[model samples]
Target chain A: MRAVIAEDLALLRDGLARILRAHDIDVAAAVGDPVALAAALEEQQPDIAIVDVRMPPTFTNEGLVAAIEARARRPGMPVLVLSQYVEQLYARELLLSGAEGVGYLLKDRVSEVGMFVDTVRKVAGGGTVLDPDVVTGMLTHHGRNQAMARLTRREREVLGFMAEGRSNAAIAGKMVVTAKAVDKHINSIFMKLDLPLDADDNRRVLAVLRYLQTD
Target chain B: MAREDADRAALRDVNWRMILRLEASISVGIGLLMLIIWALAGARHFWPAWVWFGLAIPLALQVAIRRGLRAPKGHRLLAAHGAITCVLASILLAIWLLAGARHAFWPVWPILGLGVVLVGHAWVRHALPTAREQALADRVEVLTRTRRGALDVQAAELQRIERDLHDGAQARLVSVAMNLGLAEELLSKDPQSLTELLAEARSSTLTALADLRTVMRGIQPPVLADRGLEGAIRALALDLAVPVTVGGEIPGRVPVPVESAAYFTVCECLANVVKHSGALQARVDVGYRGGVLSVAVRDDGVGGASLAAGSGLRGVARRLEVFDGTMTLTSPAGGPTVVTMEVPCELSSPRT
Candidate 1:
């Protein structure tokens, strides 16, 4: 997979590029600012773009804006945003842009090279992968809502993994349960959340996230 | 100030005593003249008694006026003035009675005038605030506003610290624990990938430490606690992309709260200089004079910075305002930007 990286810090930018290269992912361009990032995205049209949340000329959400703009120009363009901190508000924004081909994770997650590489690939393959912190924040914020209150503790756990873009089998592996049990929990979650029954994992994840994002 | 007030009170007392003595001496002289007139003139008619009464009237009025003047400021002054008016009216009535009963009661007009004057004086004195009272009231207002602002800033700082710890280092450590758990699960079955998992877990620990250090710096920079504001700022300036010249002397330790607020305000300004101003170079000047500590940050850059433009400087201003401090920005377009912040506070004695 070929990718473009936009990170203002030279150290972090080079480190990200090196990691992707080690994972057999080609970094087509490594740019430092939003302007250059935009230029590289247009010129290279790489398979994925890993962007930072803050970059010059304004170090406040410029990278996020660039990523959204890139997807606007080319729909379903995959972009993984990494930040030192993750805000629920920002996660809502990135998802609102479109759930497909989107990822938001903390910069520290890069230390887990295997997981980080897997997340990048998952996003590039048109799957949404939200950081666990973002998912936890959303659940905590919406846990008291009437619809969410109906979910059991185990079902809520299943829903959280679903929002993190985990398949039923993956959730089962994490929870140390059989895939059949995971499927049952997911069906229960869909019913409790008042979401339409959908078997496709991506569509189900989107439906669950859209429900959580509503008022 | 206490000693000065005491001296003023003593001088007033001495003046009052001298006036009393002078009035007594004058009354004595007038009495002697009246007695001489009674001895020389036909002694039976006693017209000299009228002269004696006339002299006593003025002596009585003088004593009353002096007593009125001696009362302390505020309502007492009005009270004294009222007393003097009443005494003078009584003296007028006495003179009228001693001269033969007046057909029209003529002293009533003068008494009415005096009453009007006394009422006017009382109203004026009661309505306007004294200079000292106004100053104290203003100080109270400032204390109330700044006290509330300080509490708000403190609470916000604490909340931010809590959030940073929870989201930064704490979250990273949890991830590290998860990685270790996964490594343990795979130890015997997937021993080949165990090495990579262990390395990742170790790296996670280091990242957690880095996150902790960043959070600690946000709370209270160790450098700032070790060195004063000047030294701390100098250390900060060294790390900036653009060269920053820090020129200042903070001779003694400032109260820790004020020092922290000042340090953060300066840091915010410098961060603006780096992130927005696009300056090639910057300068910082710090000084304390007349109980006011002032810091000026100047950068030669694109300029046009303002509180309304971004929350960065506005946050700084709010932080300073918690200490009754002020921030002034002079960043016209196409030139240098200068931000001057002043906080009035006393410093401890110079460190030995």
Candidate 2:
């Protein structure tokens, strides 16, 4: 898969490009600023883009806005946002462009190379990935607490992993449990949230949509 | 209740004038009664004239004091001194007349003494404070105190940041470097241990970054920069454990320093709400009205939050006072606690 990266820091930009290249994903264009980033998105139209939250020319949320605008032009355009800090408002803004093919992770998460690359691949494949802080941020909405409070500690863990875009097998592997157990936990979570049973990926998107409507 | 207050106020309002007028009339009656006595005694020397002059004392003092009160700014006391001199001269003249106008003008000696005192008083009265000077001195006092408080808060904040960086991120980075150096040494002999060290170093760097983020947030939150005060407050309300309903509107951004001060105050107040107030719910209201930015945080719980009770709020008040701001708290026991803070500032036009 082809990808574009827009990070102002040269070391991190080069590091990201190297990591994606090592994973056999083509780095179509890696630019340092949003201007070049916009041009690259228009010309190359890569399958996915990894953008930083802060960038040059008013170094506040430039890359975030660029990503949102790009997705506005092309619905569900895959983009993974990286930032030094995790804020719920930014997460919600990114989710507003439709939860599919989007990821928002703290810059620190890149240290977990295996998980970071897996998240990139999942996001490029039209799946969702959210930082744990970001998930907690969205879940802190007013009325969601009652429904989420009904979940057991283990079910909550499974729910968190699900929100992070892990499949049933992946969650079972992480939790050291059988795949059927993971399926049962997810079913229980869905019942508690009062959501219709659907495919796993669709349910993740609906979870976000359901809470967003409450506000 | 209202009628009682009105009647009491009416009584108080007329008291001074009524008392003065009644005394003057009684003095007149005494003068007339003495005139009748003198008339019965034979009325040749006109001794009633002395009685009228003596009766003039209270009326004369009243006139003099009324004029003193009406005297312009610094001249009130001097006017009062001038009134005393007049009263003294009049009394001495009356005594001289009563003394059969003899003994080498003895009243002149005492009158000279009065003249000396009046001159001294007039000379010193100008040096005393006028109303405007007193007001300016009060302003200067506030400026001095707030400046010192601000410096103290700043010094304490700098020390905290320095200590946090020294102990947290910088130490982590040093450990990361040490681990990396050891990992390189083990790369040839122990490949498995080498991988473990590398993993540890990676996590250490991430922790260092986290520590740095915390320090940077203490300085100035990036979210506050992304969105101004109102939006920043909303973002803060979301992260809180208690459900905080943030209400109100801000048309344009306040100055950055003021915004920072106001934001941190809200943060401190909300922290208190979570920690001390056994509150089930909290609320924040932010609005800019009449060139003043006001923020009030309220919680429904066991009340009694006070600046004197906690250094957290005292520091908050000190920070706000630097900008000529004010903070008021109303946290009666067994009820809701509300902290209201306000700062007067002009807003620049909103950025497009």
Candidate 3:
């Protein structure tokens, strides 16, 4: 899988390129700055673009901007953004646009190289990987607490399963209940949490998030 | 809170201010004397004048060294400016005196004294206020630091609440919820016990969640970050009973620290306006000027507000001082109270 890396620090960029290449992922172009990363991506379109949250010139969110630009150019290409800290607002901006095929992780996660690569691979395969810390921080907000309060104990248990990406059957099996019972629990959760009961692949994720937020 | 304690705090700030003024004025005077001596001594002969200039260099450096001394709040800048005047006056006075004062140079002393008269006049004009203002400034600082300390305590309380939810209440609730689900399934077998257990669990969950939400709101409001500053402040203004007209345009995105400071300042100002001022309306203005973020809160209330009374305004002054910012409160006995705070924007570009 070919990838373009945009990071402001030369040492980090080179180090990340080396690590990715070691994993047999082809590093198409490694640029120390986002402008060059953007130019390189235009010249040599890669399968995935890994960007830093901060990059050269206007270091604040330049990498995020570059990733957005690349996605704007090619909607299908996956992008991974790495940041130093858990910024809930930044993560929300990324998720609210669409959670599919996107990854936002802390730079400290790079120490766990295997997990970092796995996350990257997940994004490339059209899956979302939000930093668990970011998820926890966002859920800790006052509004989320209010929402969480409104959930039934059983519904809240189902949400924990759903947040782990479990299906209705999987959740029902875990709870030792019938699939119909699980469906009832989910419908109750949806009504209580006031979430849009839409039919979509990502609705489970949305439902889990809404449950986590309110109840 | 007592009269004696308030008087002592006022005295302490005044003492610091006096020391600042004295050190500044003396340094300037000595430097001036040195410059005059150097000029006269040097002008006696060009060769010796250079020697006098060399002698004045050490004194000039001494004055430069004094500039490094830390002065309290507004006094630092004033002290430094006063010292500067002495050095500049010495240089100009030396030239005028050495040249024999025969030409248009005599008027230089008046020009030099103009700065002294201007600063000294302003200094003396505000002399009664200098002590009170310095006290108020110091008090505001103390209050802000205390409030920040209170905030830290509040944040700690939040962390504890989070831990409590995870380890104490949420854990028990999870078990209760699980047991309730089981109880619901076996309701026909033991309807009475199952119903009681389920009811107990439901009450426990609701109480735990309510406690968690109350604690979390103190840390940060989700709406503030969600809808941005305008929404946050608008929400705040709505809560205020007194008519608070909030003016000034908020940027689409302000630095988090800047917004936090601005938010608290407005909150505190309105609180003060409500608690102390018998006012009809208060206005809070926030905007950026010359790369410095400015917040001005004005209340058309019965003023006579003094920071010496350990009013939280003193704390406000100190909080602003942390970022090299300032808070000025002007409250006349009968009318409007205007509190202005300005903070420098020192954004270190994160570039290689």
State which candidate has the highest lDDT.
2
- Taking the candidates in order, what DockQ does each have? 0.01, 0.47, 0.03
lDDT, residue B326, candidate 1: 94
Selected candidate, larger DockQ, 1 vs 3: 3
Best by TM-score: 2
* Candidate 1 structure quality by residue, lDDT tens digits, B119-198: 89977777888888999999999888777777787798899989988988788888878888998999889987888888
lDDT per residue for candidate 1 within A129-182, as digits (tens), equals 888876775665444357776778888788778777777888999999999999
lDDT of 2 by residue, B62-155 (tens): 8787667667756787888788788879889888877778767888889999999888876666667767889999999999999999999999
Off by over 4 Å in 3: A142-149, A152-200, A208-215, B1-248, B251-316, B319-352
Least accurate 10 contiguous residues by lDDT in model 2 chain B: B122-131
Q: Listing every candidate in turn, what is its Cα RMSD in Å to the true structure after a full C-alpha superposition?
A: 19.8, 10.2, 19.3
Question: Model 2: per-residue lDDT, tens digit, A1-215?
Answer: 99999999999999999999999999999999989998999999999999999998878888899999989989999999999898878877898998899899998888788889999999998888888886676555545466766778788778777777788899999999999999898788788889887886788667655543334
iRMSD for each candidate structure, in the order shown: 16.5, 1.9, 13.5
Clashing pairs in 1: none
lDDT of 2 at A51: 99
Give per-residue CA lDDT, model 3, range B48-116, as digits (tens).
454465456556745543663445665665666666666766777777766666787675766667686
